[model samples]
Target: MAVVEGLLLQATSTGLLLGALVLLLVYYLSSSFSFKEEDNEPPGPKPLPLLGNLLQLDLKQPHESLCELAKTYGSVFKVYFGPKKVVVLAGYKTVKQALVNHAEEFGEREIGKLFKNLSEEHGILFSNGENWREMRRFALTNLRDFGMGKRGSEEKIVEEIQYIVEEFGKFEGKAFDTTQPVNNAVSNIISSIVYGSRFEYSDPQFKEMVNRANENVRIGGSAPIRLYNVFPWIGPFLKSKRKLERNTEKNRKEINGIISSLQETLHPDDRRGFIDSFLVRKQSDEKSGQKNSRFNDKNLLSTVLNLFVAGTDTTGTTLRWGLLLMAKNPHIQDRVHEEIDRVIGGRQVVVEDRKNLPYTDAVIHEIQRCANIVPMSLPHVTSCDVHFNGFFIKKGTTVYPLLTSVLRDESEWESPQTFNPDHFLDKQGRFAKKDAFMPFSAGRRVCLGESLARMELFLFFTSLLQHFRFTPPPGVSKDQLDLTPVSGITLNPSPHKLCAVKRS
Candidate 1:
């Protein structure tokens, strides 16, 4: 009877211990969830605890949602994506001031879980401090030697244009989707530099890589990916986010194979392409006491992949938008054709011709501004605590320089909502550069391929426009052509066939 009583006492003690533990857990959780920005922080819509503004934000197009909030909160405001707090700089002046005037303060790349998973901070795109500076300088110098923005590079683009023209001839002036052919042509220009060779459109390997790139972009920019970023612990349960991880690995492996082959054939004197150049640098560094250890194989792979991906999507989408907008706005199309015919003539158009074709340049700029491909710029981090534009932004605060807000700021453009080439044209009808025309972004983190992209867009757009006039397929009216992008991180025009009637 005494043993039984002792056992009962022990059970009572266990129950009290469990109860106390439960109370402790509740208190910790309650205290931990109390998230609030400092009093000196910018004012914004009040965010809920833990969830922050996730539910309130339109994750698909966070830029648009933020724009709506700016109407209430002003140019500079704070937002919470889950528990993570971000300060958004809206409109042209504010974004410019932060990215340009305060460049050093806001220079760091604000990497998220998804970006870290893909890059692991090895390449120029997601790196900071010494790594970014070294890689960017190397990339720019090499690209210049390879004829990036110069007349020497013009030959490579012109050669690629021939391939596109030949493929367009296969369409026989019938309605064909220009998406793949255009993508192939533009991508080959970069491939010739990266892989030292170009792939045929029929090549399965090339097609697979392009498909994977497009898919990765879609998934990476999706709502679920953002959710995974906000709540990284929940990544295991999200299928879309998991697919992104697999996609990242697949791209890395493919690039690695090409890099391996390049290594086998590399000669110090005969540097054929980017891989050869990088390998030569890596060897030089190894012998020089590792002064520049950033020139390793890992960085080579990541940088190559980043360049390959960057080279493909951004310019290709803009060109596609150019064609769609032209098809939709026939009057604009007619003006471009006239301008090209008068300035460039029927013979093969070149990058040099962009200067003479003012109307065409204006039209191209308008299309980019209207399409706004990269609506939300890549996230950036503050280098140190910054009191920017009347708000106390702490050190390492994530900053969203809303490119869409600047591109579509109501005060900056007379008709920001409408597709008007006049925005880029002076009252005298000359090509005029606007302070707000920042499609390539501003400051230090501007795309390394800006010059290359500019040349490609000019050469490809002119080449295609010189040869054929784009018109909507079948009964589709000009106004009916959907300008709204097929949703992704970048804006892609809806897949629609256009009749490329041969120019007489």
Candidate 2:
């Protein structure tokens, strides 16, 4: 008994000593490392030691915290994520100046190990330099050539919308979760562009890919993901992190399998899917001896995969929010239904219908503005050392602009925190564009699928609202409309149940 007590005492003594040493070390580091608290640097909360302002940060809802910090630090300020300096641009004007006015200086994308590993510096989203330019050009050209922005694109979108409405109608009088069907509709639209066809909702591979994509997205902004980014060596120890990577690999394999099958069946002459067009470009480039051709199969696969990831959850989640918002504010839902009835009159509503439906358009814009999915865009890198608005953002530093803050800036909006569609409407009841509104971000690094995404949201929202009125389950009050977003790389609403009551 004496021996055991002696061992316990020694262990306790060692722990206390170690704790004291850590405290002393931290104090020393905090004092030694100089973070200039000058007027020039962007504003933020007081940072401490090696942890910086990490403890004060709310990883789940970073936008709210950023807005609070912006209040003290001003619209623009600097904060450190450990030893690294990150310049955060808050509010509309600051964001505009940094991302738009100084676009060239900040055009570089941040290439961390994980993003590079996933994209291999091949796809447009994470790739930079020569590869990015080449791929971006190709993607834009093909997207345009295949009718992305033109009326032809609208026809395709309307066709998909029709199919989606029909699918939703199957749940005619039943209360079914619309997430999968909405996701399928959005994915099919993009798939039509990429693969020239859409997969069945029941396809095992398609379902698996969607599941994996959802998992990866959900893991984003999680403590483990942030931890891994901060200390890469710790990644292997976290099983969830490993699971995320494994799942990503599995998803990639499934997507690649589809691409491989297409390659086998489609001859060089047949320019059907995006891959076919890419293969043709590859052959031409090979003949011309183009330097570092980026149109190869690997890039094609990664680009399509990126599309699947970016397109699926965002649109589906937005629809989910739309339904919830309508349910919570039945007045808004009735207004939408009235507009559809008055405008369409039992006829098909197309993308062109938005121009005629001011109330509906305002509501859709409000939803995007309020929800603000990708609040802080994928971090951008400083191409070279540059000084703007007082601070020197060093070369290779990551710049995370709180985009949602800009959208919801109280200085700009009347009811910044509330769901007011009037923010996008003028006194004339016409749609008015707000300079502060940038849900899809701005400048060169903005969402590549911005046009398509906008079209999809408009078509889906209008189509669904025209058919059915959304409501919470019986006995549930309107206040129960879940607005709590799940903290991930993308801000998703918490799981909630909704019933799509038929308009008739």
Candidate 3:
């Protein structure tokens, strides 16, 4: 008993000494590293040592919390995530000026430890400098050629929309979860682009891959991920962080499998898909003795993963929001149907129909505005020391361009808090363009698949609405439906069912 007590006392003393050392370290760092109010730093709530305003912010729905902060701090201010201080640019004007007027200064994407873990420090999404420049240029050129944001893309989308329309018909007017089918259909568009093929709806591999991808996105916004980004060495002990690491690895493996198959059958003369084009470019680079080329196998695989994941989730989740919102607001849905009937009755609705169906276009824009799927965009970094709005942001400071602020800025929208299609409509009911309509985001690093997503959203949304009237499940009133989103890096709807009643 005496021996045990002695051992316990020694261990307790050691723990106490270690804790004191940590406290001393924290105190030193907080005083030395923290920005002072007189430093011309963006004004914000006073941050606590080590915690750094973490308690003041919501981990789950940070944008909502950040919106509240903007009320107190104004459009441009500093907010710390952990010990890291991030300058948040809110409202349309502020964001536009920073991302547009000062593009070069805010062009670099901040690669947090978790993001590095996901991308393996390769890929366009997280890379910087010459690598990012080369990858972005290569990707944009090839994607445009393949049909992204072009007339050729519309044909691909229309083809895919037909399958989804048929799939909706299968429900035969009964309530069902449209999540899987919608995700599968939307993801397949990306699949067709990247891998040159789409998967069967019931394909187990396809379903698992998507589920894992979504999980990674969910994880990206989890507290564990935030912690991992701050303290990467602690990641091994966090299950969520571990799971995210595994998901990225698994995603890379799956993409590599597809790339390997494509490589074997890749014809030098004919570019079947993005992968083929990349392979052809890689070979050309090798032949030209461009030894330090970025078109290697690792880059190709990482980029494919990047495109597939980014393309699938943002657009898929937005489509889901569109259907749910329509169900909740039948009058708006009726108006949409009326416009479709008046504009493209007895014929397939195409992207061009958007110009004619003004109300429908307005509804789509309103849906995106309300959905605000990606509330806080991926963190950006200051490429150089920037002096803006009387604030001195150091070079390489992590910055967050909060989209939620712009999407729902009171100054910009007539009914920012309410779901009103009139937000996108003029007095004449013509579809009006809003500088604040940045669902695909804006400026240099705007979503790469913006054109593809727009085509998909219009075609799929119109086609589905044409074939079926979405509604709350039987016995569930529309008022009872929840529009509250599951907060993460992106906002997603909670799991719920809606009826897809066949239209006459």
Candidate 4:
């Protein structure tokens, strides 16, 4: 009896100790979650140790997840990206407030490892301080002077649109992939501006450059970039990804070689292309004995490459989506065609044509909004220690515009999920621009190629619709419209081909 009683006492004591431990753990967890409720930082979902809210983030569609989190939190919320924390700005109000109102404070580029190798001293996209100011000013002025953001540029686009129309004829009304041909047209436009020349679609070197550009654009933020971020030292372990890196290096060399050859051939009297204009600037600076003139072959080459990269794929992808959408919605396509015919008649449509074609103009704007490319604008860093929406965003902290959230924010749009051009149009049918319509972004770092992109979108879209009615091949329904994007550095439609059937 005595032994049994002792054993019972030991068991009861063990049970009590175990229960206390469990209770302590529960208290710790609950306290941890509730501890920061009184703080001034923006409300956020609970984070796990080391990882924080990383596991909760959806890698595939981070914007969607962040949007959901925004409801529980607010327009501006902080979320952890691994050990790193990124403050996401959602909706027009928050995004505009940060990007436009406080533009300078948030103007720092994230400077990813990949871009560091490529554009360390290149131009405006990555450079800081005097370099950024100088290059940005020079590029902007030069582009504007060369007719980038004005009616003067319309002639160049009109010419390219004509070429695109000619190529569509080669399809003979048969089904084909419009990606390459569309890209070629855009490349020609940029090439005309930068190199003062355009390449034939048949040029092997041009084709190779196009391929490299496509590959680079397609691989951004892929598993490889993430892997590099996680295990940067393991570059040799990931051989395939290393190959992509090598290919990118090869592309840089080729671009440099081309620029070098062009420089040798450029005559002192003749200044054509952006590079030539830059050389002229350099020579003038030398004559003036200006020290450390930023206008050099390196800067010129980087700027040219940047133009091709940012302009080509982005415009091409949007057009790809636009045509796909038009095919799926023939009524909308017809209305656009009708507008083009009614407004411009048989004359070549110019940048000025937009004022007369409100419906078409609205449709173009809608396409840009709906596409929502660059979900996060190539990561931006805070320029200095600053406060945003009550959060203590430290200096050098990386921030994302969370553009996808803004574009598709239910709070801002009538039908956030649907493809509605009416969002950009008033009840009276005039084109109404939205402050939220920031496909090219806003403020200090707004797209350098905004004018060129808009011109291309209008010209190519109208020109194509004027020439042909795009549709799926017979037996394929609009339901089969591969709306599934090939999501990479750029949002692109799948490999589905379409029939650009020539209109009567």
Model 3 weakest 10-residue run by lDDT: 8-17
Q: Backbone clashes in each candidate structure, one number apiece?
A: 0, 6, 0, 0
Q: lDDT score, residue 151, model 2? A: 72
Is 2 or 3 the stronger prediction by lDDT? Answer: 3
| Candidate 3 ranges beyond 4 A from true positions | 1-38
lDDT of 3 by residue, 75-162 (tens): 8898876578889999999998989999999989999887776566688888888888889898999888888878877877888888
Better candidate by TM-score, 1 or 4? 1
Per-model C-alpha lDDT, please? 0.83, 0.76, 0.83, 0.76
RMSD of each: 8.7, 5.6, 5.4, 10.3
Give the per-residue lDDT digits (tens) of candidate 4, residues 80-100. 654466777888888889889
lDDT of 1 by residue, 362-410 (tens): 9989988998988878899999999988789999889999999999988
lDDT of 2 by residue, 374-481 (tens): 888888998987888877677787888889888888889999989998998999989898888888888888887788888888888988887787888777899876
Name model 4 segments beyond 4 Å from true: 1-39, 285-291
Clash tally for model 1: 0
Clashing pairs in 2: 42-76, 42-77, 42-78, 43-73, 43-77, 220-489
Model 2 alpha-carbon drift over 4 Å, by segment: 1-40, 289-291
As a whole number from 0 to 100, the lDDT of residue 217 in candidate 4 is 79
